[model samples]
Target: MKNFILFLFLFFLTNSCFPAIEKPDDYFYAINKKVSAVVDEPEEVKKIYTRELQKYKKYRTKKYLISSKYVELSLRKKDKHILVYELLKLNDDKYDYVSIACNYNLALQFEFSSPELALQFLNKAIQLDERSGEKYFLPHLYHQKGRWYYNKKNYKKALFYFNECLKNLNRKETLYVASMHNNFGLCFDKMNNTKLAIEKTRKAINILENKPSKTKEERLFLYFIKGNLGGYFFKLKDYSSAEKLLSQELNFYITENYSSEMINPSKQLFELYTITNDKEHLKKLIDFLKEGESRLKTTDRIEINKIFQKYYAGINNLENLKIYSARLSQLNDENTSKTTQELSETSDRLNNFIIKNINQQYAYQKRKNILLTSVIFLAIITFAFFILNIKTRNKRKHDSLERQKMILENNKKMLEKDIKLQNEKIKSLYHSLNLKIETEKAFLNSLKNIKKQNNFQTEEVLKDLLLKVNNLIQVDKRNYDLISECTLQNEYFVNRLSEKVPNLTNLELKLCMYFRLNLSSKKISSFENTTPNTIRVYKTKIKTKIGLDRETSLDTYLKTI
Candidate 1:
């Protein structure tokens, strides 16, 4: 029992000391890459949780070294506080490598936030990796540098890095090749090289399709490629192809609830429908847009508004077109101003750094450099400084212009609000006037009802009054004939007939009443002192207007009514 207890205690102690096995170097590198994709920087605690490099030997292999170097680089770039603690704990030999790699990574980190520093670190990383023969990470380093250049809108340099990545593609790195191709397509698309963009995107799609299974990241990229293809077709005005691809992409977006994929296809469809002059299809597309607009978040509303504006313009709905266009213009102005301000700030920082560097160089050159070289360097630096300063001032001026634009937008919005209020008032007044007119018509109808009721009580008196009133109003003789003939035996039938034939001429109403009572046409003609042919003609006209075929018995239909 003592021996068994000792064994169990030892097991527990070992297990407690070693909580969990750390993942392989490749695994940590992949995890770090994924985290970097979604977040600007991972927190120190998150990095500590994710990275378990201490569990493994420090200098296992060139591959492990590179991966470990990347982890430290990522942590330092993110400015994780844990880095200081980790650095202090490392052995001297490992510390030397970490220090150099960390410095190189620091340069890369600054490349995004501070390009000058990024260039310095990239150079250092290249030099160090060259000495160590750690070329496994060169592709990634190049890709990142390319991304930096892309952000700076230096397309040619970005392409150079992408091409470098392409050159490194092999059987072991198929996924990387696919990713580079996708990135290349994006760059080409931005540069408006549609043909090359399509070619590269197609290549990406092919790679994704052949893969047995895809991660979520791969699927997202695939969907993006599909959306781009749809856009390409749309731009070419091959709308049938555009619609098919866009519709497929739209379905995918709906299933995934991806807001980013919703608007472009909808706008493309709207444009296609407009071009085709398919009114029914256009209406359906409009309903789709409205639904998407309602579902979209506030950040996506600008895109929704753009689509709506295009749709409205296509339909020639000028009022809404103008409203959305104005809104778009306001948003653009605000964005432009913000961008200009940011650029100016960045330019100012760059200028300050340049000035400080120049001053330091002057100090050093005073001690070491020859007179001619120093003069030439100073002249070049002075010219560059003045040019950069001018650019900064212009950017600031642009920002000021943006501020003026905001003021104008505010005034425009106020004016629009006043106009809207006035329009509402006008609509309200029109409605009120319509109601009044309806009320007057109803009062006149009630008066006519009262006159008819009194006529039933005193026939002789009513007749004399009717004759005098009809004469004064210049009532036609035919109207009297119509009224006289419409007197039916049943009041219900008379009331219903009156309701049905409200706009009927008096003669026609009378004929209708007789017809409803099952009176023969000849008998009606004799009663009315007219020819049977005339009665037949009037009945045919009434039947045609009422949309009743000759086969439908008018008398029977009227009786049922």
Candidate 2:
């Protein structure tokens, strides 16, 4: 907090983020990135937190740092993943002030995603303090609760919580104190107690302006007071004060790239400009107002339109007045609709209150009936349980015997089923082995006949086609990767061949694979992408490696393996 009262008043001083956001997305972006990192990569989360915190070590809010921001990001994204939940649970287990601070942060986060969860976290934080018998950041927790209620438009409850914050909070923590003061001012402003509101807002302005803000959050809070205080001045019809404060605030918001709060000051300034007949300011205001139609609230739209209407009326511009008048009528109808909506809301609130009271009474009566019925029911169940227990004791030995016999019978049946399954498995394996033997024989015989017919090209193609056998046999040679294709087709054969005949060349392997596939030397030449002489030389080198016996053929050796 820097002393802005003297500065704002003395200079009539100025100064104002998200594109349309009430808050700057950039204001939250860094926090979101860090928080997301914390959730997704907790082990690395420490280094990031440490680096950011170290930068602020000499700063006033070094201890607080941005630890709560992780939860804020998760809450904004409505991340329901167990990672963040577990992180919260882990922190909540500790009863220290830091942990309580963490809990309060989580409470703020959960207020958006899960209010009940937020309540639970707050209660736990409260419990931590209550058990410790000392206040530590509980004021901050209370202040946040005030904000939570304030957002929901429960000004009275919000005031109650803000009062709790002021009563319990330390005066030395100017950041929090200033925030509470600002919030208190806002609550009073909402209540329309102009004198009290003005007093509170001025107090807030002093605290914020005097103390240099320690954190981004503090700076943002200070910015908020600028607009809010401007709004209060506008309410008092102090146009000079409102214009000075609000204009500065708007410039600050623009510089900072923050949003929603800008709407408040922007509306106030436009009204001020129109009332003061400041054409230059009014024209400048139009640049923003056109783009801001969606950003301004209904109440704000109505107020702004009234200013425009007044401006048109003052100039006696008939066409412009007609346009403003028509828009004003439409806006007023909207207000009427909004007023009807508020009435419906009030009726709903009253009905809900009545229903809640009735439910409280009904719940008490039901609970009483249930307690009495439960005692009687328990007595009956106990009596029945006693009888059953005694009967069970007498039958215990006989039941044990029966159970053992039944177990033995089950064991016998299971044994027979196992035996049957084993026999079937053995038969299937035998059949498969026989079928494989016959298939190989037939394949070899067909190739031998092709060899007799000297149809080497046809035999080579047939061998290539046969490479598409079931995986249990061989892989299809579509890739023709000579190094691994043969090895993959029959690992045992490749391994044994390599073991017996070490250092066989790739060309030799290519020749051997064709031999294994029952292709003639001419077919092997064609498959190897080489001349027949090259195939002959490769086969000779392979034969020399294995020291192939003149009595046994290469195909027979490979097949045997």
Candidate 3:
């Protein structure tokens, strides 16, 4: 008994003296990375929580870190109540990382349920992250906020946030930058600047292509961008490019069993084939659509039926056209009947409430009159007042409901009419422009002019074509101007940098100048016609040549020089 007591005391003393060591920053970072890597593996994530996170429960900073990770995992699993509970438990002022993570995670959670709530959380996250000054997740937060604005159809605000995201991202975050460009494309697409939309989307593709993907998610993201680009191409009537891109995306979706995603490419193909009078492609698309009919929403089904009606009518297939017309009418009636039934139910409820109120008032009035016959005048005055109040209240309620119903109907009609007008306008513009054929014609005319003027002088022809190409691609002049401006502004800085790092190459010197101007590797890569990864390598080499330690920031160092 004495030995046992002595051992317990010693154990307690040892534990009290040592306690559990707080995890270093590197350990925390590694564990965070590990959790992210195994997030898709439920068993692995469970093991991580049990073996690693559970041990740190008593430490405040580490505890919050674990809680943040749990919240993130809960979000992925869509465990809403648990996520909310965890978020509520977190002390936002206790740790900046935890606070930012909580707000960001909660914002994502609220995005589908309440966009306003999502915006509030997102703004808080941004504010806190910015104030913290580390900016580890600032760009991602910006992108999420941009996505929120995009979903709300505030394309201008979405673009602003997306541009901010792009401005803050570095070359190392290639995938994120690519996503922001894709968002830019989406915003431009919504704003009806299809040309600019196509430009941004192509740039996104180029960036993704230059950076090899290491995961299925990244590849899928690339395909998603391609699909959007294909739609943009279709809008611009570049049917060949559109056909190729859409076809690839359709095959990918079918193979991946992404039935919902399959509808978009299928619909675009159906329209394309009908417009081009390609019966072959139309029949194939029809087969695909019929096979996946159960996967489509009612709106999608109605749209597909309309497309079929147009196609069959165009081909003079009267029987098929009649069949599709019947289907379309039935679908429309079904959709309309749902709304009508809802309105009828609402009206019935209001009538029932009014009747109930009247019956209650009648019962009370009868009791009052029976009990107060001796004071009949007073009773009459009280009953009149009661009846007048009820009537006035019911009248106000009835008027309010009627006004709301009328307003809703008016808004619905206006929205439908506006959509119809917009669709008509787009179709007219597409038919009138015929951009592809017109552009080809213009180029051919230029070639003919060159042939006639130069009389087949090969050198002159080449020179003229070169001049036209240069005129078309005028971005180089802007780049040169920027470089010149940067050089002039940082002349003393450049001299200091050159004196400090005398062996720097021309490319390295240029990179230093760009760094001084705070240009990201992505932007510098564009100017240099090289990959961002290569620019990053040059940056590291510059840091080494300038004798900056690993802990020192190259950007800050260059600024000081």
User: Best candidate per TM-score, number?
Assistant: 3
Span of ten consecutive residues with least summed lDDT in model 3? 10-19
Q: Count the backbone clashes (under 3 Å) in each candidate.
A: 1, 22, 0
| lDDT per residue as tens, model 3, 1-561 | 122222322222111111133433234344556666665577776777666545555553445455545535532545764665464454436656556666776776677788898889889889997996666468777877777888889999999988998898776656667877888998999999999999999998898888755455456667777888999999989999998998988898778776656667777888888778788888888877777776777877887787777776677676676677667766666676542444334333433343344436776466545534534554466568778988999999999999999999999899769545643443343333344345456667878887677456788667766765564345344345444544455576667777887678777877886675456788678667899999999988888767677898887776556
Error of 1 at 124 (Å): 3.9
CA lDDT scores, all candidates in order: 0.60, 0.61, 0.68
lDDT of 1 by residue, 47-162 (tens): 54344454335443434434454455444545553463344234222423444445444554465468876776666655654454434345555666676677788878888987
Query: Against the true structure, what is every candidate's RMSD?
Result: 35.0, 23.7, 35.9
Candidate 3 residue runs with Cα over 4 Å from true position:
1-29, 56-72, 75-82, 212-214, 255-257, 291-561
Q: Counting only residues 3 or more apart in sequence or on different chains, how many pairs clash (N, Cα, C under 3 Å) in candidate 2?
A: 22
User: Considering summed lDDT, which 10 consecutive residues are worst modelled in model 2?
Assistant: 9-18
* Regions of model 1 farther than 4 Å from truth: 1-119, 149-157, 169-174, 186-193, 261-285, 318-561
Candidate 3: clashing residue pairs, number: 0
Q: How accurate is candidate 1 locally (lDDT)?
A: 0.60
Candidate 2 C-alpha lDDT tens digits along 1-561 = 123322221111000001223332233334444554455565566565565556546462422244443333234444534444544544445325445545665675566668777878877777785665555455656766676687688999999988897888667766656766776787788888877887887887788678754555457667668777777788888888878878887887777766445666776777788778888888778657656655666766766666666666566565665665566556655656542444334333433343334436777567556655665576566668778987998799789999999999999899769545643443444345445556666767766777688546875758644852453263223223433433454555567777776567655655675666555667556545678787777666677567675676777676555
Residue pairs with clashing backbones, model 1: 482-506
Q: How far off is residue 12 in model 2, in Å?
A: 31
